[model samples]
Target: MRFASIGSGSRGNGTLVQDGDTCVLVDLGFTIRETEKRLARLELAASAITAILVTHEHIDHLNGVGPFARKYSLPVYMTPGTYNREKIGLMPALELINCHQSFAINGFTVVPVPVPHDAKEPCQYLISSGSSTFGILTDLGHITPHVAEQYSRCDGLLLECNHDPDMLAEGPYPYPLKVRVGGDHGHLSNSQAAGLLSQIELSRLQHLIIAHISEENNSIEIVRKEILATLGEWQGYLTIADQGTGFGWITLN
Candidate 1:
């Protein structure tokens, strides 16, 4: 099993997870043209993707889903609320997923864990192929007990470290937007990400990718200092998935 990212931030977000011949896209935030370009960087073509799984209706995650799916004639899976909340035009193949259920997509087993975000039916994914499990969690406010337990074991994880509380509180966003971001239904802060790291089984985690960072409210340096402080002497790889070029493909053997 292996995974790579197209981009990770408020502007756009997409992740690719593959096992053998089956390659699935978690979300599509870029235009069809941009998605193709980004895929080319990873030596991939859009037609090679097996399916697309959507987490929510947020523009940064749903923008390119319809166009890309229609162009490629690919199957799309998402919760019904997410599909109904947004008019993404006509989808050639759409599958409605239950947030609490685990389903199969080709060789991968996808577990959709519901998250507390400001969306209709937002959920993150835990994808497993063979013995390697990869978890992707983002755009959620706080970590629930269910979330903690579900993500405790993974070979690779893409965890959201969206902002620093101090920076967000003093940033240029409007008062309501700041409150929304720092609120219970908003993105996770760096400290919160570290706290979750402290709870999970870090020994089994081979790679940890920090994702969905706020361009206006957070910096890589700040997140590094904070997360590294929590990581301490942990031996796993720590990678930051930036808005521009999300990290390259990392394999799980």
Candidate 2:
């Protein structure tokens, strides 16, 4: 299995997970043209996407899902709550997923684990092809036991390091916005993300890609230092998913 991030930030977010000929996109947040361009950067065409799995109704994750799915004739999967709340118009093939169940598309097995984001029926994904598992956990406030258990054994992990607690406390966002971000239903801080690593089985982890970093409220150095502190001397391929050039494809054997 192999995976690449299309982008990751407050502006937009998308990820490409591939196994052989099957490629799936998770949350297309850019416009149709922009998504096409980003895909082109990865040497992929929109038609190459076998399916789109939506996490929530936030614009940063749902903006281009409707148009892109319609244009490419791709199948889309999401919880009923997310579909009803977003009102994503019409789709060529729409599949309503239960957040508590596991489903298969092409060669990938997808496990939708519900998360505590402030959206209607939010969930992150754990995808696997045979024995290799790739898990993506982002846009959630606190990590629940179920989430920790589900993501503990991934071969590759795209974990969200959304902010630094001290930075977010004194950052530019207004008080209420700050409270929301730091609340139980908002994004995770560097410490919170690191805390999750304690629950994860590092021996099985081959790739650790830090994602959804806030450009304004956090810096690369801070996030890197925080995560490194938690990881200690564990040697694995560590990377950061950028907003502009989201990192190249990473293959897990």
RMSD of each: 0.7, 0.7
lDDT of 2 by residue, 36-117 (tens): 8898999987777899999999999999999999999999999999999977999999999999999999789999999999
Q: On residues 150-185, what C-alpha lDDT tens digit does candidate 1 reach at each position?
A: 999999999999999899988899999999998989
User: How well does each candidate superpose onto the true structure, as a TM-score?
Assistant: 0.99, 0.99
lDDT of each: 0.94, 0.94
C-alpha-based local distance difference test score of model 2: 0.94
Candidate 2 local lDDT, residue 225: 92
Model 1 scores a TM of 0.99
lDDT of model 2, residue 52:
96
Q: Model 2 segments beyond 4 Å from truth?
A: none
Worst 10 residues of 1 by lDDT: 39-48
